[model samples]
Target: MRLRNYLLTSIILLTSLPVLAQYGSQKKADNLFNKFSFVSAAQVYHNLIEKDFNADYATRQLADSYAFMRNPDSAVVYYKKVVEQPNVPIAYYYNYAQALRGVKAYKESRVWLKRYKKAGGEINDEKFLKDSDFINSIFNAKQQYFLTDVNFNSKYSDFGAYEHDGHIYFASSRNTGVSTKHIYGWNEEPFLDIYVTDKSVNDSIIDHKSKLKGDINTIYHEGPITITKDGKTIFFSRNNFSKNVLGKDEEGMTNLKIYKASLIEDEWTNIEELPFNSNDFSNGHPALNNDGTKLYFASNMPDGFGGTDIYYVDINNDGSFGKPQNLGNVVNTDKNERFPFINNEGVLFFSSDGHPGLGLLDIFGTVSDKDNNIISVLNLGVPVNSSKDDFSFFMNEDGLSGYFASNRNGGIGSDDIYAYDRIPQLKIEGTITDITTNTPVPNAMVTLLDSNNKEIARLETDDDGNYEINIDRDTDYIINIKKDNYIEDTRQVSSKGLENKVRSITADFNLNRIVKKVTPITELYPIYFDFNKFDIRRDGTVELDRIVNLMMNTYPSMIIKIESHTDSRGSSKYNDKLSLDRANATYKYLVDKGVDPNRITEYKGYGEQKLTNDCDDTMDCTEEQHQANRRTQFIVIKME
Candidate 1:
């Protein structure tokens, strides 16, 4: 549904006009305001209480235009000047509230929100309710206890504070060097280092500091620290200043590298460099998956969205690192992004100066699935962010209390840490089972969905076929259950205002046997393979395992011939050998995994001789259609 303008249609524009006796116009300021054209057509309302001051309708208009341009900070400053007028419109406060929200002044935003409501300014209540920033402010104020002053000093730039298990880990630039005084060009503050602080101390009156493990602290740049959910592994940034890795530059410092420190017994030891560190580029600000199978970090490597990008390095079977793959443009930009944190819910939190923010670098978060598909990147507005470089974020399962670093004064140093509590909006859960037999379908995938039918989570049924999904407590969600030999099932449920409780929702599906009339590959299609190679991916082998299980259940005594073929793109002789290798690879995988080799008796490679279509060998065919010729089939030669 199209949103109708809730307020008066006559949107006033701001511009400056010449008054009596002042022959010269304020050309520079007027021109500056005009250049920042707004997307929506704005009126030229004149705010003319000025002789030489750069004030007018356009100045006011420019502030509103800045909001449209997503430069909320500029808008806030201009709106502040406009609201000072004795007789300004109530709408000015309303627009100003939004600008305050953009810069992450939640309390100020709330004050304006109240003013907007008091003045009877029009707004979409539904939209306001759905605004994560507005909702989070209310949540933090009610559920969390914000930490007051952390007694440190004007000696560091601390931020990106987060909580793991029970401890708080943050980034700071506290004197750890013979002459530890480095400055960030952007904020002109001291360069950062990682720090840990505790939450058990009195926060409102005074802030206590946490100690670092020995001299684990480095003199070079360090930030974006994270601890595993189990509280065993600690990951943090280290500027790669290794003498061998980066040949001593004029500054004699290497690039940056993310290091992992593990806790063995009660002591943290065995500090080692992460897998993807190199001498060429800087790689830091790592975010680890819950299972520790994937590591996400930011880098300025080639083929990135812009400057620094978030990259994923998959963990190999032997715990070694794989090639780092860029997370693509979804989570990255040409702008500098730092301090990435991943919650147990798979939501990602980071700080960026590129995306429009209320200040220099504000904290932002995006809800993502296990596959890293981003649903939205929302600003953590108000109390959490401000008109300064507010970053180094952390959160708990409850989404209430967490810590972050900032330079908003009232701290021990150039930057200090703060903590706040918040309320978790809502969540969902359910189970999937067999309808006819009332038995659990182990390993079945149960997905929770939103209004757009986007899958939020793909939970697997436990050994007994019981599945539980945790989501925000008050949102609506759809459930989809998919299992082999069972009909696909879908259901929708709303958890609006539902308290934190395990909702018992039973989604039972009937098992449907494989009927010949149905599409055979409905269970299998679009098979995967390596680049220019016929070997199946590990996941493809898993898929084939299901096929093997199905064949064994349906025809226990059946003798089948496994045939593999390849597209006619290459020479027939080469195609023949490739096809045979693929068939042998599949056979070996099945055999090694305990599938009876005798039941998969014959293995044949047709060598592009068998075409599902009528295309001739030399005919020009699309690669997709050619793929049809390169296929795998199991023919039941004999069944008992």
Candidate 2:
């Protein structure tokens, strides 16, 4: 009895050990995750899953952790399991959908997106669901930027490139001269610091880099800055560290804040934190308008639409700031929106994962009115974006060249700076020709119209029937060709895929010539006859109707004669009778179709005498040649 009791007690304790361990592990993982230590939390959750202890919860947490770390490829593996379980959270459906997109699984991502919507989850962008072709349009849009990595990138996180005073200012985690470095837990890299490098005349290269001269360099994170036009002041993002104390919110987390410094003589001094910053949330990635009248940055203070939202404040002439205002729902989504850049033309460029993109975060541009209301957002397609996080976009006043950063593959660092130049031009060129003789239809009026049928330009073809016109990229165009004695031709052409590398597109036009005077009906379609047959074929009647309509409607006073010929396969006497019967058959067809009998001036048969080729019974020829000889013609006799 004692031995049995001992074994039962041992079994109970052993069975309870795993549950206790799982409970403790779950608490630890949750704490790390809430602290924004996603990398550490993911490892703990992954271990719990491998042991099959609280497997469902562990899987969900693991998926969330990877998602927060922007490791979608790994997150998708765990999310696939979490979403399949019963009673899954509605938010997980959205997370899975976004994860699927990060791996370029767009079709599957849309499926979950619809499920998320059906589950009462609100999607801010209704157009994303209503426009079924939206995703396809993003993928099919023309490539506007050509990107190349800068030569000065390091093996650490190097990004946030900006230009001012002949120097390129940026943020990097490549800490130098620090005896001991404090590493950020999120990416396991050194904390970010502000750095500057001399800009080479050739934009592709850069001179040696050094830390910005100032007391601005702190032990905490700093950088991704914006400077005033006169170079008298600067605004940069840093951790909530001031004086000698590091500030933390009630949650024991350090948040980002914007700080301003003045350039005095040769050193930057008088550092002061922006007034609207909070210890409870993050506000960073600063940008300024062309005249330095507005300051824009991303923040998640409170009541934001997503993890982070873009906000801007007015800069008074006395160096004071107004209240921060959200950029509105049109530009903000249920995901992180960061790195706001305003060009000289008032176009805003930023990065977002919420919008439909190839994968991860994609850079998008929007034009705003004077009141700062966005009209529409456009994805900066192709080499400018990739299946990874892309942010910190900067455009020069010229708007033709710029710089951006991405953590995509084949880079020298966790993130790398890239230079981009817009494609110069796109053109459409083509030739116009007549259908009858395949001759050039020169001097033809060629009109170009936009997709809405609005005329854009009109010109005439050159002496060679060729015309060339410049066109905008990624647009649909209609080419209308018209010439005297030729039927009008319209063609729909798209310049979508041609923007990648091809500079020009060829769109030739062919116009059919209308019958005006004496001409053989065979010029349009040969009125063919079967061997030894006199009845009009179904095809032959179609050609006969054209003659009937021309005489009755188009040219009421026109007259024509029906003449038929036969091949050399039969005797001359037999061929003559067959040809005559065919001529009479055509004559009767026109009269039955309401053509005046007076219009048919004559009906005759030429028999084998008018053999078109050398197949006069003695010379063997192909069937096509023999068939050509057995044809009928409706020659115009007179026209008034």
Candidate 3:
């Protein structure tokens, strides 16, 4: 009986060799594919197909290869074929469902998703629900969650991404650092360079095809670029090689420096070193404010939480900088927190590895004031993060879709940039008014236009003189409020900079009255200006141009008064003189811009006499409200 058992075991071992070999080859291919080596894995899987025509493992892996290559159609073909086989693992259906979702087969994705769950499949549930990739389809499918895999680069390790003016700037360690001079092993290259790319609306991404007409490329480690809204200024992280004679005995490396450059007439010059940067500590990841007047960044300097702390600096009027202020214990912890991003509305977003999250490093957003006080902080959670390190997130103008860099699983290479469209949460609202009565007009027609100024939605005002419209995030929209007897009022909302927040716009409409030459001072919105300034800033330009255009068209035969005011910052007599000069300057500029001088009336300045604030600079009053006391405005006094 013992001899018979031994014979049976030997026969079993001999028979299992072929099966074991086949499993080993498939496992190897899967491993290679997971590491982003699709070419080698595809070749191996191809060989397996030739050896065993009945093997389905190789077929699944081959589909994954096509998916890694971004050929979703071929991936779908193989994935669909795998589902037809009996007794396959539930992961096949789950993964195939994700692939189907990637190719935008919402109905089919729901079918496989339901099948996987029914077959007891479980993995990455949060990804299915939260990832912006399937947001549209998942909502359409009425499904809660789905499975997702990242697509990375096979040859290069991308670390950072910044979007501006229809182009993308990023840091990469691919096909570079061949020489020993710039050598850093494992994490990244010694000289991580910044590369620019033009991403089209289509799925095609082109590198170095942007119209960046300057020496943006540096020999040293020049990376992590943050461009301003106008694309005129750039703040980048760089490592400068300076001989450290006293700090080190011998063989010391260079110091890391953050540099600022301005684009002058399509060229980058006037490169200046930021004073807030310290030599002993590494200061990088500079995030610029919407107006480019402040910078939020990460530094390892003293008086931090422990590792790296987020800091801020104010750019002064004379182009100088103030002392760096550390963002306190709320937003930053005693960890290697870095990669700061500040939105236009002073919302701060960053990545932190030590924070409680679903991934190694999760992206977090916080609301902050000008004093660097963190009001609220929230982790982006599952969809925006993963088990691996996730960082370098940027939202586009519409806040819906943008590029983020990550080293997550199932990527094309080491680290690849992924463009994700955020699920939109938008609310459109307005009030309708009578053309002549100056009261609410019920049931007025309203049309919402998209970024290209195309009509997207329509609504009507309620009896309460209010209307609300819902929309997706990341959409450039225009609100066109029209009543039968009134002029069509069109307004625009720039959703490009608003990624994950609600935008409120008041679309107030006023119909043309039956009375001739309608001119109402109370009806016009109040215009505010800074102290001792005649030139309108960008924000002020929007409102000022509206008044200018109104006067030029509606009140063409009228004479207007340009009035200026000042706070009690100086002596009343001196303030009055300065205000008069500013008012005259504004008047001349308008005349030069083609506004008829005969239609222009008197220009007057009321310095300290017409002060808006009760307290002067010498009195016990805050400087903030005092700054608001100064102003420039116009009054249509007489009709020609």
Candidate 4:
């Protein structure tokens, strides 16, 4: 029997050709690929993928080869195919989104990224954000900003701009030197170096661009540079180096480091590398405040929040560096963050792929109030950001117009510098109040729902019953005000076609109280009659339903009185007659909907005699004010 079992195992192992190759060729391909031997690895992965189309390992590696090869068009083709397969890995959804964005398919990229976020556990095939909080996060999208590419962008990669003394300093790969022969394996663009352009005008016109006069532009990639207010001190990023020779890691690749250069007789001299830089990991994208007391940069160093978190170090008065401090989880995520820029107003702007965004890296801003204690981070929405990689944001000293970088669609090169101006604010503000008491209703929840009743934004009324919603442009919104024990109110507002016009709207809610908890003698809510109409409308039925449910379930033998009233517009005889019909109608509706008629002992019509608010013939009142007088109430007369 043991011999037979062994024979069966041997047969099974021998016949599983696909499984064997999946275990064999995939490992070889991955090993070769990790060594950056993309040419050989692609060939091996290609053969394996051809045999089994659903082989995720082979398919992923092959696509990654093209992605790392800076061939997004080819990568997207494979990724699109991979995402279509059943039981695909969730991470592949994100990868496919990135590939789509790289090819400038911005709209398509968002669909895949949303799918990636939805690719949760197997038990639930619906949206991953079935919970309330997640649903709220993606309820609204920002599409107000206007982004236009600056003309200074070269045919090569030109990005990361800094403005000083009427000259703009930025990094580019325009291939101005013989070093252009050496291309980075990733992205295949020429090694980046800083360039200064002395142009004054703001439009797309470009002129007077040249390399930095100093030795700042090196053979390897040199990244974003930051200058202090005095303009005498500068900190820039470059490849890890010792004595001008590029330093390589164990894998024979270069990492980034921060170096400080001092202005000596108009020449940037005395270059000293900051101490905390590691040979294995990277630290790049230096940004400084006006005084240069602290330096912020992005790094993949050990024990960080995740991939490439932003870190800050204190630059002491004597030029010594302090220990690096991670910016915490609020500012960092499990993915990459790069290109941090701090403006003069103490606002910290950075880029990240981990935060909720359009698709890829979207620029985010963090700011603090005067005490430097209040911190808030906001996503700088499109067109300043896109479904593509947008990073390295820098605002001018004036804090108005500035520049950022993006590999987004319609750019002239691989990464282009884009000049942007802040868009105007559009908003809606309101208050919720009780009509009878004429008092503000604090803690009232105001929800702004779309046409489908999906809440885009919600807030509670403050202590003064005030609520504000920063509405989006060209969208119709339904504002719902709800509070416990009060009738819910809804109003529809259209924001469409209000883009060019500066319009902020005011909306107010006056809710009638619905107190259904009868105290064996307490008065219930008013059943309002509309302009001499004696019929119970849908609003009146809602109150009647609540009363019916309470009396039947909570107070079975309780006796009650239904009183209906009309406004002071009609004669007393006419109003009293109309009010009686309304009271009868309310009672009939309750009896029809399974409410015990015996529980309703008597029905009365008070007309306008028992007005809740001060609105009479002598008092000047609008239709809305007069609505308070026209109401219905149910009083519990006796208990079992």
Best candidate according to TM-score: 2
Residue-wise C-alpha lDDT for candidate 4, range 155-232, written one tens digit per residue: 788888999888898988777545336577788877888877766765443422376666666778886899888888
For model 3, the superposed segments whose C-alpha errors exceed 4 Å read 1-154, 176-183, 186-190, 201-213, 242-255, 368-372, 426-468, 471-640
Off by over 4 Å in 4: 1-144, 176-180, 201-209, 367-376, 424-640
For 215-324, candidate 1 gives per-residue lDDT tens digits of 34554566677676678777778776443343333465467788877778755567788767766777887888767778888888767778787777887778788999
TM-score for each predicted model, relative to the true structure: 0.42, 0.48, 0.44, 0.45
lDDT string for model 3 (1-640, tens) is 0000000000000000122355456545644543334556677788877886324556766775665444567778987877886544456676578778777887988798889888776545564444434312222222211223323232566767777876667876554324444555545554467766654544233333332356554555666879877788888887653332222213464555678889988777667778876567778888887788888788888888988888889988897889998888877888978889876545677888766666677777663332545544556654567788888876554434556667787776677767665433334455676533347877677776666665544556777667765443334557777666456677666433442423343446654423235555433343555765656556655665666676688767655678877778778888888778767766776787678776565678888777666777667777687767666677655543
lDDT tens readout by residue for model 2, 165-205: 78888898886666778898898999888888878644433
Q: Candidate 1: lDDT of 148?
A: 42
- After TM-score superposition, the amount by which residue 346's alpha carbon in candidate 3 deviates from its true location, in angstroms, is 0.7
Worst 10 residues of 4 by lDDT: 5-14
Off by over 4 Å in 2: 1-140, 201-209, 369-372, 425-640
CA-lDDT, candidates in order:
0.59, 0.75, 0.62, 0.70
The C-alpha RMSD of each candidate to the native structure, in angstroms, is 26.6, 22.8, 29.5, 21.8
Global CA lDDT computed for model 4: 0.70
**Best lDDT among the predictions, by candidate number:** 2
Ranking by lDDT: 2, 4, 3, 1
